[model samples]
Structure formats: C-alpha cells, structure tokens
Target: MTKNISKEIPKEKRFLIMVILLTGVFFTLLNETLLNLAIPVLVNEMDAAPSTVQWVVTGYMLIMGVFIPVSSLMIQWFTTRQLFIGSLVLFSVGSLVSGLAAALPYLFIGRFFQAMGTALLLPLMMHTLLMLYPAKKRGTVMGFIGLVIMVAPAIGPPLSGVILDFLNWRWLFFMMLPLIFLVLISSIFVLDNVTTVTRPKIDIRSILFSIFGFGGIVFGLSFAGDESVSWLNPSVYISLCVGLVCLSGFVWRQLKSVTPMLEMRTFRHPMFSLAALLLFIGMMTQFSTIILLPFLFENALGVSTVAAGLILLPGAIINGAISPFIGRIFDKFGPKILVIPGMILLVIGLQLFIKVNTATSILMFILLYTLVMIAIAMIIMPAQTNGLNQLPAKYYSHGTAIFNTLQQIAGATGIAFYVTMMSVGQNLYPSTSGIIGGAGRYSRCRDTVCF
Candidate 1:
C-alpha cells in the first residue's frame, strides 16, 4: 500500500508545492491579459495585418474555452504530478515556440498551446490544495492561492509594459523559459501523486457544446466596441440565438448526465449559489477594468508603457498583500464580512473610473484603483472558499473546476456585457446630445433623454 502523505506533508514541501502551483497560476493568469498591452508592439514589429493578428488574442480565448470544460476530467484522469508537469511542459513549449516564431500564424498557434496548458493550471491547483490539506487548513491555503491568481493579472500589464519598453515583444514569451524551468523542478519535488477511483468518462458531446457555445458568445461580444454589427442584423441575431440555445442545451444535458461536466446540483445550495453570483459580478468588473486600462492608458491618459505599469503596480501589490489577511479573516468570520466591504470598494472604484478623462493624473487614478484591487482581492478568497466550502470533500476536484469555470464564464460575460453597454451608451448619448442641441426638437425628445 502507498503510504498516505496526508499527515506527513512537510512544511517545506507544502511551501515548495505552493510556489510551483503559484508559478503555473501566475503564467496562466499573466498570459491572457499580458498580450493585450503587447498587441500594438506585435503589430508594428511583426508588420502583421490587424484582422489576422487578432487571432493571437481570439485564438487564445477560444482554446481557453475549448480546454476549460475538460479540466475536471483531467484532474480525475491524471495524477496530480502528471497533470501539473504535463501542463507546465505544454506551456513552456508553447512559450518557446512563440518566442522563436518568424511569422504571425505560428505565434498564434503557440498561443493556443499556451492557452491549452493554462486553462488547466488554476483549477488543478485548487484541486491539489483540497487533496493535500486537511479540511480546516484548505480554506487558508486556497485564500492565498486566490490572492496569487487575482494579483497576477492585475499586475501582468505593467510588467509586460516594462518588458516591451526594454526588449522586443518576443521577450514576453522568452521570459517564461527560466520561470518554467524553476516551476518544473518545483513540480517534480513538490507535487504528490495518489490514485483515486473516480475517473469519470469524458463527455465529448458536452465538451463540444461548451466550446462552440462559449466561443460564439465571446466572438459576438468581442465586436461590441465598434460599429461593426447591428443587433437588428439577421446574422447577428441568429448567431446570438444559436449560441444561447447551445448553452441552454449544455446546461440541460449536464443536469441529466450521470457524470456531468458541471454539477448543477451544487448550485442548489444557497451559499454556493450566492458566492457564484457575487464571483460573477466581481470578475465582470475586474476583468473588464483590466481590458479597458491599456486602452485608457495609451489613448486617453497618454501614459507610456513602462510608466503605466509603474502606475498600475501598487494596485497589484496591495491586492497580493491583502489576500492572506482576508483569508485569515474569512476563516475567523464568514465570507459576508469581507465580501460586502470588498464589493462596496469595487463600486467606488468603478464610480471613480467614470471621472477619468483625457487629462487625468496617474497618481489620482492609482489611488482609487488600489482600493478597487484590494477590495477585489479581499472578496476573491472568501468567495471562492465559500463556494467550495458548500460541497463535500470527494467533490473537491470537480468542485474547484466548476468554481473556476464559473469565474471564466463570468469574466468573459462581464467583458461582453460591459462592451455592449458601452456601445449602447456611446450610441444613445451622442444622439441624445445632438437632439438636445436643437432646442425646439429637444423639447419634443425630452422623454428620450430622461428615459
């Protein structure tokens, strides 16, 4: 019989494993948003067409959607060590390929590989935490993990900006090479492999459904910023309808399956559902804000790449610093105490953002933004812990995936929803302002502006 390492996980081993897991999580979180800031750099340096180069971003998102739903199966199918090392290898290889690529398509292909590995890293780490730690300790450990995951993306842009300012955009991929080796070594020593019986059959149909449905949804939302498509257009409406139907079908199928890709029943628990809802809301604002920052910094704010990162650094730093404390507090108190305050801070941050114009100061922006980041970090752990806390130990592997999948969907949806709302606001606000410019017509259309 294999010796159970449950009671014997050394402190050094635990710390090493966490470092390994965080390394993977860091790259995963960093890769998604890092490239947003690098797009202009890539376009200029590589001389790539905009439509074609966009695949780098879109392809990564699509692969993330494709691979995410399968993460739960991977946890059960492969040993923790197997999954951890395998994913790291894939990501490392992808980064190397992208770093060395001579052409755009190859770079995108490399990004797809990177996305494949990244999609599994976070959920798998959460599963590992649950498996490795005792019940009481799991929350604390996960809180720290949550903090790492949250801060990495928040800081990714500024870090990437510094890299791009000093070196070529390829350095973004090259930098990962050394970190990848460090993480690989850590995985070999830190990760534990134990056999479990619950290797549920992979539901290929549900997997395809999730991929197509989510992909369609994201693709449609990606166009929200420009005057690209009208909602009244037949093609737009059809795609939206089909995407909604496919997602509904995926949910319906999950409810009936013996081994569902997502366990809908878990959401039946009130606290779990509420946490999931709040997570959705938080991710919506946080992710959208990250996406918007690069555009704002570059265009409206006129901040240089290195300068923007320097400006953004404090938010990420404060966010990371506050997470462990939030975790400890959540363990002592319930999630509500942290979640409520964190959300209020988030709203304050968002409200402050509305005041940002072409002449805004970086110092003033960062001050408000830091509060948003801290608030988000505060809520993330408690919310994630609260979600996982509702389920039993056996479901930990699957449950973590479900939590992350919810986060992914929420983040994606938040981006889509915010873009759409902004588009609507832009269209309506200008037209209304024009009508108001004409006093005679303005009186007739007064209800339009008020409404």
Candidate 2:
C-alpha cells in the first residue's frame, strides 16, 4: 500500500496479501532442507566432490546472509508488490537454471539465484505480518505462522526422498516450477502494494564488509573438509582470514554509522545477547543434524533414499505438530520455563546423536532426531520473543533483521563445519577399518577399497 492508503487495511485484503506472502515463504523454506537426500545422488550423478556438493546448501544461505541486510533497502527502493514479484522471479529462474544444470558450477549458479529470492521473501513477509496484526495478538498470530512455516522444511526430506527414488536429482528443483508459476499468476492478479518507498540511507561499506566477511568464512569452512586439499591450503585459511577481517570491519562500521544497516546497540541488552547466542547454537544444531543424518543413513549405513527420508519424517512431524502449542505454552509461562527444559533436551539429544553408528537402529535414530527438533521448536521463537522484549520499541525493526541475518550465517557455518568433519574422519580412516560409505565416497577406483 502506498503511504496514500488508510492506516488499517481491510480484512479481506490483508488475508489475500498474507496468503500470497506465506506461499512464497513456504517455497523458500521447503528448498532449504529438500536437498539433503539429494547430495549423495548429485555426487554420483555429476561426478562432483561431496564437499563441494554441499555448496548447494551453504551457498544458498551465504547469499541469504549477504542480502538479508539489503532487504530493507529493497523495500525502500520498491513497492511491496515490486519486491514480491522480484523475489518470485528470482526463485523461478533459479529453479529453472538449477534443473537444467549439467555440472556443479551451473548448479551453484542456480542456487545463488534461488537464495537471493529467499533472502528477500523472508523480511517482506515479516513486514506484511507486522502491519496486519495488532500488538497483543501478534504473539499468537506468529505462533500459528510458525506452525505452518516449520512444517514445510520438516516435510522436505520425505518429499525429496520420494522424488529421488524415482527420478534424477534435477527433479528436486523441477518439481517447484509449477508451484512457482501458480504463485506468480495469483500474486500478480490479487496482491497489491502494502507500503511505499521510504528511501533509507545507504551504507555501501557495511554491505561490502558483510559480503566479504561472511563469504570468506563460509568459503573457508566449505573447503576445510576436502580430502584433496591440504589443511594448509590458502583456499581454506586465506579465505577465512579475509572473511574474519572483513566481518570485523563490518561490525566496526555498524557501530560507527549514524544509520547502521543493522543496529549493533540492540545487543547491549543482556537478554538479547544471551538469546542470540542460544538461537545461534540452536540453528547450528538444526542444520548440522539435517545434513548429517541423511549422510549417515544413506551413505554410511547404506539405507535407501526413500527409507532415509522416511526415517527423518517422524522427527519432522513431531517438530511441526508441537510448535504452535509451544508458542502458546510460552505465552502462558514465559521463556525461562520453556528455554531451560529445551536446553536440557537439546543437550541430551546431541549427546545421543554421538551414539549413532552404522549399527544404530532406524527407530533409535528417529527418536533422537525427534527430540532435537522438539527442543529446537521450544527454544527458537520463545527465546527470540524474550530477547526482542528486552529492546525498546525503537529497535524492534532492526532487532528482528539482525536476528535473522545471524541465523542464516549460523546455518552456513554449521553445515560447513559438519561436512568438513565428516570428510576429515573419512580421510583419516578410509583404509583402517574398511568402512563402506566413506571408503566408497572418496575411492579413486569408483568403489570402496583400502589404501
């Protein structure tokens, strides 16, 4: 809506806008975990490095970290409808490019486009949601949105798993095209601009720093596990150094700027800082497990792709089923009550993940994964709400933005770390125990064999 419109939008209009935005959100989130089961298949089908194959996931999120800061800029420079169409177009093109890709580099290019679409859609949805809901009702409203939002990712593995069983990995991206087309048509006809351009101050330096900083770090993490590369490879260390130096510059610039891209001061609130830390850790856990389990079941234990997806399904379902209720529980009791127990459960769950081996039962892994998801559901929103509560009204806008940006970065780092560790362990013991999965993964003769 232009600034020319009424303060309160009509209910029918609000519902249409929300439905369109949520559809976009669902598509973006679904792609996030959909490819976990596809990684091994891509490695075999494309003759790509397993480590590099991970870029399909990390590259997407890295682009997200870069653009999330710029989302505000996008809103100011364009109308809500303009931004919405732009994001959808980016996603559509990305899906098409990725589906047609014949090599790893081409796939990366497609993922980059998709990530940009996703980065923009997230903040836009939040902006529309905030405008539509009143203050007191937003908590419950967000709770319900959280319910729907969380389910998309939860179901991704199973959905993709079914696809992988019958089709090529390209179908993962191909399947989304029809849905994207439908959303584009509906949005063009039904969705209207919600807000006009506000033309905020631009910070070129801040954007540059974030790009180089997060980019360097994720690049470093992605390579750290490649058995072909030395631990001392410049691609690993130099990129890391550049990322760190650039990120330091980004932080300094944010602190010095009068109109920072992200508000650094919100962190001064003790609760906000604490909650950010907790959420960061939680995000790391969620991402690492999502990648690791599929690798374990499919690659290590020799489980079928459909079977692996089915194994992860229970955890996904349990996580989605309980989320909205968890929000209600938080509303009634407050964060500490949930956060404390959630932390306990998360810790216990991670500990059990360590116990997983080729011999571990499918049922046992399901229980462990479900517990972790449940803990995460408990921690993420409630802690976020509590932390935002610590800030005054003025910081609310940037507060949420900063929080989301950090989560994307955290997820990238987590996936890179886990992928690297798996590579490292595979490299160190490829011959010692005659393990099946890791042995076959890096074997030069195209089959598992001892050195």
Residue pairs of candidate 1 with colliding backbone atoms: 158-309
Best by TM-score: 1
What's the lDDT for residue 141 in model 2?
A: 46
Residue-level lDDT of model 1, residues 121-142, one tens digit each, is: 8788887776666656655787
**Estimated TM-score for each candidate:** 0.87, 0.84
**lDDT comparing candidate 1 with the true structure:** 0.71
List model 2 lDDT by residue over 1-451, tens digit each: 4332324677687778778888888888899778877888889988987877977976776688778867766766688789889999999999999999998888999999999998888877766565565544455545655665668887887888788778988889998999988998999987877655656688888888978987777667656634466548988889889989998998899899887777788889999999899889888877767666666666656787677778877887787778768877766777888889998998788776655555667788788888988998888877877777677544555666777787876776676666666666665446343565354443321111100
Error of 2 at 175 (Å): 2.6
- For model 2 the TM-score comes to 0.84
TM-score (C-alpha) between model 1 and the true structure = 0.87
Clashing residue pairs for model 2: 1-193, 1-194, 1-195
Off by over 4 Å in 2: 1-7, 10-16, 39-54, 102-105, 189-196, 225-231, 352-360, 389-397, 418-451
Best by lDDT: 2
